[model samples]
Target: MLSVALGFAGPALAWPQSLREGLFGSRPSDGRQFAAPPIARYVSEDGDVFTLDRTQPRPLLKFDNSFEVWALTPQPAPRGDTIYKNDLGEPVLRATRLGGITIFTEQRPGGSAAALAGVGSPLRLAIMGPQALLERLAQASARASRAARRLIPFEAEATPASSALIADSAMITSEAVVRMTKRADSRHFLDRILKVRLVEGRKASAQVAQGVLEVTVAPPQGLAGRPSSDRIVQVAETFR
Candidate 1:
């Protein structure tokens, strides 16, 4: 049986040995790039294994206590992207497409702006925290809470995409499950439904899930009412 014990050693899941060995290779478009599909596998702490064939946005693990989420792209990003960093000097490693959407190879989690541009989109994000395993429904709820609020105080010109979506949604689904394994009591289980709403970025909001930290964008409306592909092309061509 899969081990759900709080302190026990997690499962040992591994990608095909040959596939794992072949992942870190170069492609023709750029000398420093490589393709990310056909064989990328990330295993969760509970031995749940996720194999990447193409770039899909999904979490790596979900359980009653803890979880891990991961997003992968097929292309490689370049080396000099500024979206990889925040004003605080922390590094971000997921790519989000607002207008432009391209995926390069070398941009694992942090690529240079110059490198990231090749892949399209200026925003990239990744959220890894203690409560990473709530499943998609709960994750969406958390995201909606964080995205529904506005980040008035700004230190930079850019805004985060995930935060915008959450703020717009406002209400999070209450049915989503929140699982927990208490640190004090390993055998005990603490499961509940978490409802979150963004009150303040720096200060605590009226609604929030305890033990969960969120990473998201500032302005919540940037991604709303996104234009169609044809409209985007027309606009780009008009500028040209």
Candidate 2:
């Protein structure tokens, strides 16, 4: 289990304001780089523990027995939501601000512990306050509601070459379809489903028939590296 220490001064001070100040504020009053106490602590699967401190203008990671520190700068979120990606460009660490509290998730490649131990790997910790946890649960509930309401069912045969299921419908954008197929191919079955549920949310639906896969999706919302309609359409047509 991972533990987090939120440096809250008092109950009167809102967490969002404090979190922003800690993450993006100037040096502390004492002129030291890091705060007196760390904001969070993470224990890797290898049993190595790390700490995150809000040191002047950025966050710093410190490990036991190592004087060296890895500084992390905030990166812009892809969709400009409360969710933010780290500087690594991969979804290493995602910090999401709900209302008062913030939520953090550690995203490792293939969700492997060894991969998480790589140099500059994001901290594998989930720090959630009561409000933050409630926010997540609410968002999840909303997604489930939307999925139940808008799900579309269909049937199509799987292509022999790629084993990709094909569904032909103008209602689904080519980019959305192709991206969904690629996601299905690349990730584990459960992971693929969860990814779609989180990203597409109410925007798309997918299911499999006897020997085929079926999908229904709304227009593309410009996910990273999504191809143009012409190219995606061409690829989708080839499946049949």
Candidate 3:
């Protein structure tokens, strides 16, 4: 009985024949290329129309919102090791041993695209559009290049709540002003700061997690007064 409830329901064209013909080209009058299935129509208690093969291991709904990205568990590939499939039945990206995910932009809606793992790992398909992803990559690349100078505030220890602060090294392009502030702890006494300076000589502050770093191209005018919090530090204490 339990098995029957989750039975394999194969593909069925729910749309009208005329619409289908318009989209997929003319249907054969003679029963050579096409033939109607034994069951012309089906009525279930739930009115959801069924399509696509049910028996095939349906890609897990890994991420779905406005956009969709489906990832299979990490597997060996010719170049690297992980395989990612899109909504359509196609493998669109690869994750290499060198620790980066290569997105085959040609396979995707656009042509030739890829993203790194840690920079923007576990990408949320819904909120991130193609242009957004590209912009993010550019920012991450800038961050990576300046990692030595850039003071990133990762917590000294891993816990539910931790505050890591960095001063003087986060910048943002004007177009990608998607600022979101978050509280890591209840008291808010302990928090991290992200200082962002825009290209046109403007700046802003966001309270973020230890892992979150301020990403931008050019350095701002002043960094000391940006956060205005005691937790903010100018340099790596351990280096000194």
Candidate 4:
């Protein structure tokens, strides 16, 4: 159903309508500005739809069939085309100056061509129902707790009381917990975290202390005023 095929010359990468809400911001408040990163939806040669959003230092990759997001960085490529890579330094996407794209994969080491599917929303937090936030918080907590083999309760505090941005930040924080525990390198960090706490701010930040994972979310920064899912995981990262 959802397959990443093709070669280098025919690179295909796309984001979905769900991905248009992301706006450019920071990896962690570094104050670096990204040149106009496209926030557009695209269809691959193989017919898979993907989305791209660069509301932070890194771009976020999305697919239509699933909600899983992968963060990528734009790099200078040959002949003016740009290559997008994950933190692991793997080339995941390439784009031509004229809006053509190539997504690299094991099946298609060369590439594939992609076309603009349609216009997408400007980078912002997605308009989610309040009920969805509550459900996401509960589900993220339950899943993270199960993965950690301990209860890692997720909670949030917002200044305006009704700011959906803050609520979205909290939701992102909760999702970050899920992301953190899923990685082998970070899974052990959750062993010491008894709870994950989120609060509103102008930039996303986190600290692990006293058995608590404290995350401060930028209300109008990152993706939709909350840190992107991967940024929160990076913020909550432990050196120990």
Candidate 5:
């Protein structure tokens, strides 16, 4: 019987008369009309979906796998706690800042549980200034080149620093590193054939401070002759 309340505010701007009538309903005979309250919905990590519609006493509706109605509860979450809602605006998670770490709780049936349940290991990354960050990127690229050579044994001898960097940055996967190296080789070949100067796109950037780290990877801008665009990757995490 877990219940969560989400307060939805009214629309900020006024709509045109025709559009307003369609959304808020027609004017009543008494010359008074009441706008419909906004509805909020959310899906749990376990895949439970529910919606909350504003009423005199708010009601929550849960749906099952077959889209059938499940449990309905009227319980509201404790005040002062910030509830993180889903795209539908229904509260699915709550977080509170403690001394160091932020505790996130997921709202579910029967009871609430820690959102970061299986995450026990502390993730750490070196803090680097602008120059160091650039140097690291260059070092990483050099390592990837050496690793690529390992794929084809006769090219060049792999460097010890490249091997060490690959082993240390467990944040990045070996497969991703290999893929990057392959792309680098392909770019080189394309440049040789097309005779066009193509710069290597910025792959990733990371910053760590005060136990919080943020990483961003720019979208891949494909080879010179063959242009391609991929989605950007961004991640923010907290560590001990």
Candidate 6:
């Protein structure tokens, strides 16, 4: 069912020319060119599309039109299957060894068969100059502010050696804001947040306190480091 359910794809192009059934069990088009982490796309019966990236320590899932990234925990299921759950311990999707998939959504609590949408891109951060990185950080900040419907000032101090980390740290902060805004349990916390600041540290960490979102980044872990997107959101949730 590669039908472009929505107009997201133009008339000239269709999504997933030959989408299969089991995305997780299939191999990528060319593993040699992209010697990177795995990514998979799945669509539900209600036309909900999501991409899962296994680049991070924990698998991360993100909706096509949303900025919120969810950290998923994989649990062993019966019949050589695996169940993926969100931070709330709610099972969101399940996969079998034989390339079968079933997803649980609000519309389908009993689970719907997930269609393998297409091959996903590797979760690789683009290498850019300092100015570009700063611009990207600013863009991410503005997006988060718009999503939260508030003026959340985002700032980061970057040294010559820590420019990329600083930009990524700011991005992580902005993503956390989006994540917080999406959840009813943590959305109110964004109202109380005034600013988000990211700085270099010996280790990565994030916390929300006193109307501020503080993020610290440690290099060496490079682009895929600790204090993931949802972890920062979870930190904001703790305030409430």
For every model shown, the clashing-pair count is 29, 0, 7, 30, 0, 0
What order do you get sorting by lDDT, best first? Answer: 6, 4, 2, 5, 3, 1
Alpha-carbon error at 216 in model 3, in Å?
44
Instruction: Please say which candidate is ahead in TM-score: 3 or 4.
Output: 4
* Candidate 2 lDDT by residue in tens digits, 3-111: 1222211122222234434343345677654322325543444445445544334454545433223335566554443222333333333432211113233333433
Which digits, one per residue and each the tens of the lDDT, describe model 3 over residues 84-148? Answer: 55423356544444433334432244323222111111221122233333344345335533433
Q: Tens digit of lDDT per residue, candidate 4, span 58-154?
A: 6776666544456577899887888997644678898765455777754676876665654444333445555655665676577667666677777
- TM-scores, in order shown? 0.24, 0.23, 0.20, 0.60, 0.20, 0.64
Residue 166 of candidate 6: its Cα lDDT?
66
lDDT of each: 0.26, 0.32, 0.27, 0.59, 0.28, 0.65
Model 6 error, position 61 (Å): 3.8
Pairs that collide, model 6: none
Q: Candidate 6: worst 10 consecutive residues by lDDT?
A: 1-10
Model 2, position 205: C-alpha lDDT score: 41
RMSD of 2: 18.2
- For model 2, the superposed segments whose C-alpha errors exceed 4 Å read 1-38, 78-92, 98-240
Candidate 5 TM-score versus the reference? 0.20
How far off is model 5, as Cα RMSD? 20.8
Number of the top candidate by lDDT? 6
Residue 135 alpha-carbon offset, candidate 3, angstroms: 32
Model 2, global lDDT? 0.32
lDDT of 6 at 94: 85
